[model samples]
Target: MLFVRKSYILPTAFLLSLIYLLFSSLPPAPEALDIDDREFSPPPKQNGGQIHWQKGREKHPIKSYIPLPTAAAPLPIPKIQHDFPSESWYRRRQRVNRQTAVKQAFEHAWKGYKKHAWLHDELSPLSGDNRETFAGWAATLVDSLDSLIIMGMTDEFEKALAALEQIDFTTTDATQINVFETTIRYLGGFMAANDLTDGKYPILLKKAVEVGEFLYSAFDTRNRMPQSRWQWTRTAEGLGIEPSRNTILAELGSLTLEFTRLSQLTNDSKYFDAIQRITDQMEAAQQKTKVPGLWPVMVNAEEMKFTDPRFTVGGMADSMYEYLPKEYMLLSAQVNQYKSMYDSAMDAIKDRLIFRGMTKDNQEVLFAGNAQAGMPSKEDLEHEAEHLKCFLGGMVGIGAKVFRRSAEELRIARGLTDGCIWAYDSMPTGIMPEIFHVSACDDMDDCKWDEKKWYRDVQRRLSKGTSAQNAQQEGKSLVKTHGLAPGMTDISDARYFLRPEAIESVFIMYRITGDKTLQDAAWRMFKNIEKITRTDYAHAAIYDVRDRHTPKLDYMESFWLAETLKYFYLIFSEPTLVSLDEYVL
Candidate 1:
């Protein structure tokens, strides 16, 4: 519609020189455009190594991109930690405090609480005839706790954190012990938020150090991380690598946060170096996993060959990009390539695995490989709900934000907003299901986990009465001991949809741009939670999925849920620099 035909007359030599400079530095643009910016579903073979980005499904199928294996590099990924530069002495004090950091330290504590070793959201909080299993609780807790903390509601947060004090990270628990939380969430959030509350809050640089040391000890690096996702019980210590043992996705993503703090707090290049150690290893691991140049969910420590590709490690991608771009200033040209590759990976996520809006029914139609687009059909309801939530959650959290796809990013953001509203309004009760499988696993054991009784129960439930629809709501009449509501599946993990984690992304969207549309959207969420829902904290249970898991009084997530909700409420109603800066990550 708008074209300008004016051409500046420049010397041929000058024009030629300018063109050369541009091409030398810029990333290559692909010949084809990426699929839709939202609801992008990718098979495992879609993007091994192709960088042009605009190929439809066939252009770049998923395959691992294995870099040549070499001994671990001696240097850690370099850091650009020069301090805030223009920042002052008082601010620095707040950023590095010990005692004054107490306020924030507790926040770090809850981040610890949400880890795999501790009381998960649903099970730990309310166990009895009507309680839930460990996994159910953690999923819920991750949401509730993340939201509550962000909202500035610390009292309840402290209670949850205190609950975690009872568990020891060194011991094996029912669920996987999360090295990520032990390192990143607790350390990163505290250290970053230091003096962040208007210099009123002090930093707990020491606490962050303590957490890192503890994580290093727990991981021991040799044992690798826990075996939950792969379904290996800690008891089954020698389980094979075919299923994942260490969760590198969590491991590396958390490193970005923890290392950022270490670099700032110690002024020690070494602490920051340690972070680079993990990231560089991950980069190399990606290279190792490159079936042609694509990444899979999990890989072995030694071989570098992928254990599985179905899991794409979205969180890993998010954190890597979040820290790397700025970290580019820290590296020599050779190492700086890490930042370049990471940026491209981010572009790839935008290019695929994202969509404007997709119908849950159609997407969850079978397993989760890829969905065309449309709302869930009646037959698809129970499976698609949670899958959509996590998929959208990862995008909203940091992927969409870092990529800076303003319009396209916003569209992906709305997918969550609209999807949730649709789920709540359309579902007979507000309940969402545990998961929607996309790909098929030839091994039945692979499709289901070895350790999780919760998953097993659901598998049994689905198998009963001939099919998912006719299946009797297994475990009806809430088990207060385990907190199993009838219509709901496992409460702990299911609670991810509850609390504030569900809405924090919306708040972030609002915070970044301060768009009224986002705010309005957020307000709609707030009202639905506050007024339309049952209780202040419950966010009002909507469990019509199968049976009555509980009275729906159950709000058993870790704590992120409440923090997220509170964050949205404050930004939506108050809308100020003071409030916004306090929660800055």
Candidate 2:
């Protein structure tokens, strides 16, 4: 009994010693993560401040510009003037509101895309903070940023700028040449936003120049192509990666716009020339077209020259034109030719495509009137998104500058964006579905369920993260309820439209002319989404609160919400906030 007792005590003693040793060997707790009991500062004296507006006010040229030392209006608050701002400095609050809604929806939809680190071989969009994703996400970020600066939200905009810092675009990394979209989306938007925000958040011009140089050097003689994909050839260490062929038109259009923007920012003639080369390439390419059209999505850069006209022309063609006319205005004096081309193109597009509405069954597309033009195939989703982007971009360009679109054109654009929003408002609570394509199947006569099967199939594959079962169910439900050609479904769910691209156009209207309605809209959308805020997958935004395990944040895609929301918040805000106008230009 004594021997057993001794053995047990010895074993227990040994175990206790080991435990203490292990505890002692462990490192101390991290100091950075400590949540200390914080101390609060003393409250300030509430009433002793004297009213001296003159102390803060700078002397101006006119005596009328100066104000007396005392507060100008009621106690505490001065009488703030809401006067007519300069024509160029016009504010678009109404449009900015709608753009905010666009961002809210865009954020939820964009989270489904894969990360760059995952796709080590293929082009990953979310490669860096400037861009983790390619053009699609970048465009969303810029669009959102546009609204953000307008709304007077500097905190969020700064966060976005911080996120962009992750993308280091150096000439040494040849394969890492996806900086073009960042320039167009982040840099350009920042330049414009900084201009609007009183210089609080300008993109560094030196970085822009460095990025522009990288972009300029990448384009080869093969129709001014930028390397879409690249990898180290193992030929040399310092020389960097070898280039892979295939550059998409959509990206090229993106590059062209950046070049144009850089030229404007830097006054470098070379950027203008680089932009011209893109148009030259567009002219060089050939593709099928029913009217003034061309495919914007390039599958095979060498073999396919803008094939599939209906899907491509809307965004790619229009985007290409974005930099061209502006760059032309800067380069040569023949502005008349540019104006003429726009007019001619407008006529062609009006005649060939675009139906005003579907109020009448005849306009419902398919039988003889508007519907007879054939539905888009599953392959055309990319095409449609591109066209939608370009169409909106072109209209904004044309309406804002070219020909000063008739009151009718302005009305049309307003109607178009409004219609898009109304469609989203009417959509089913959760996800937005793919489009209800017009009936154009040649074999429709043989199959009764072509509409349901086609769209259901298309939506599942295209709408980013939707499940196949859900897509089919929605497709069948839409077809069963509405049936055949010309029926309407919640196509607003398309990540392309859900983003703030259209709202950017609306913001243009507000900017060109001071409109308080835009400001009201921006405020309303912010409040609306704020109510819907829910955390998912460790990210936060105006999320689909119903879903769990999806925080729904893609830095690139969410930039639209992050930036544009801030833009709308800034311009109409109290003067105490930081200025954006100085930084953007």
Candidate 3:
């Protein structure tokens, strides 16, 4: 459902009635609340634990280094003007129960990982085995540390802190490492945990510094650009490495937030300087791309040039665009380049990428799609959407509010979010697939369902050898076989990877607009995902979200705990707990 802000207040008697109907059926409070006032003991010290860089090591005295500028004021938290009274006791209790439910789910998965795959990158919930997708560095443990503290699981947080002490950044089982994933999940995790605890735990910062040094080795090239995928083993051995000639936009552009945060915390400009160079290159190339405002998916990291004409806000380019506004906020609005770059990219996205999807119910939803350089015009937008692009709604929402953009941006954000919610509801298991195709509506404001057009589109996609009548008959069978939703004609990739993008946006929209309907949408998404993905140990990814009896993939990514459940918990908890005004989260 499209979320519209509540502009009116209910009468006292009607308010009470509404509360009773809303919360009376909610499950009773659990034995314990998700949050508590418990405190944690400091973790034991490591003996001079620090990674030594073999080359390009520089030290800046605090006196000589200038700290990044801070904003004059924090972004104001938006408040609904309606005179809805303070939360009723029933509503508060219901929120606590929902938060508790999310906390319990996190605990189940944490216990499973601790028991079955401690110190590994990820846990195979179904197989009860460990997998090292990201340097075998206890990714889930580190990633979930801040989430644990935010949920008031002090004991679990303390245990995770202790486990963090045993991690060795000097070595890894994998010869090569992905710089982007490591920076976000590992470095971002440690930095976030450190920030949440008010810097009480020195070990978190220490671990972060160690990981940062290891990642910094990727930038030791002729040019300051980093290797998207680095041979860490060679770097550890003091061997030489070069930046990749062909790298995606995300790998080169997503490092700013984490690296900049590290510099702010440690007062070392080395990390920030590395990423700033990349940002400067991106800004210089902004207008040089085939699509002037947007960067292509692939680029030459060494030459710092766009290498592909294909542009998308999906897989290879999502976080690059995502980090622009976030980095602006994180840097306290001191850097105007980030703002300029973000505005340019978003303008291109709104003009060339967004499309209206014509669903069977004729729902008016907007989706961010793909574009090619040689397209005849902006109207030739690809009608494919990816789950990863769902984050755009929240990103755009934050930009709109923080930058004081027009109300049109907020409206666009709502349409984008509604598109994702529709995808989830339209699926049989109530989870959007990784990638799917939809029928395009000619007009964004005036969309209509046309079954004949859908059938014709399907017929045209069939093999050339097939007869027209046979093609039409086969199209119907294909629809049933693929479990295509009413407006959908094909399923490109149907797997669901326990992603957090959709819920992430839902949580953000709820916070920014204070919309109760977004919470309802989040609750339905959580329940459907938990029901379909849960196993005896923990939740697993599904083979296909459109299948009623889909098999489970034996995988659990760290973001499942770090982002998915964390967002769910935050949405159900008090808004003041992680107030948007105080943090860039």
Q: Which candidate number has the best TM-score?
A: 3
326-372, model 3: which lDDT tens digit per residue? 77767656566888998999899998999988888887788988999
Evaluated at residue 370, the lDDT of candidate 3 is 90
What ordering of candidates by TM-score runs from best to worst?
Answer: 3, 2, 1
Model 2 Cα lDDT, one tens digit per residue, 156-245: 566656655544443132334354455555556545554444345445455456556545544432333345443211211212222233
Compared with the true structure, all predictions reach lDDT values of: 0.37, 0.38, 0.79
Better of 2 and 3 by TM-score: 3
- For all predictions, the C-alpha RMSD in Å is 18.0, 24.3, 13.1
Q: Write model 1 residue lDDT over 361-450, tens digit each, in one string.
A: 322111112222222422221222343343344234343443333555455555545544444333223433343222122231233322
Q: What's the TM-score of each model vs. the native?
A: 0.50, 0.53, 0.87
Q: Which one wins by lDDT: 1 or 3?
A: 3
- What value does the lDDT take at residue 541 in candidate 2? 32
* CA displacement after TM-score superposition, residue 121 of candidate 1 (Å): 8.5
Judge candidate 1 against the unseen true structure and give its global Cα lDDT, from 0 to 1: 0.37
TM-score of 3: 0.87
Evaluate residue 409 in candidate 3 and report its C-alpha lDDT on the 0 to 100 scale: 92
